[model samples]
Target: MLTQDIRQSAPVTPTQAGTVATLMIEEETTISDAPLFVPEDIGAGLLLLGLLLSPKPPKER
Candidate 1:
């Protein structure tokens, strides 16, 4: 989400007072699958995780 501040120069009606307004802007979106973490990526991540979690041999004194 994004936002922008907008100030009115003058009020439309004599009885109304000028006011500041906030204009909400939509966040940019990309079509890339990296952020989505697709199935294939999840699989690869799990494989890497398994390798990291594997037990190592005891170190000799």
Candidate 2:
């Protein structure tokens, strides 16, 4: 009886673990496909470029 219970429970744990892993993978993919992150990255790059190319103030002697 104990062996039968262990065998049954073993399958259940793996099935649940697989489901959780699949959900996590799907969520990660969804996050990666989000449109907001790309624009933010692009905006940051443009801002950095602008800052780098901007003229500096003349230093007072």
Top candidate by lDDT: 2
- lDDT per residue for candidate 1 within 1-61, as digits (tens), equals 6797888785466333223222244457766765564688589889999999999979999
- Clashing pairs for model 1 are none
Per-residue error for 12 in candidate 1, Å, reads 30
| RMSD (CA, Å), each prediction | 15.0, 10.7
lDDT of 2 by residue, 2-58 (tens): 555443444458888999989877753334544555577589889999999999989
Once superposed on the true structure, which residue ranges of model 2 sit more than 4 Å away at CA? 1-38
Best by TM-score: 2
Worst 10 residues of 1 by lDDT: 14-23
Flag clash pairs in model 2: none
Model 2 lDDT, full chain set:
0.75
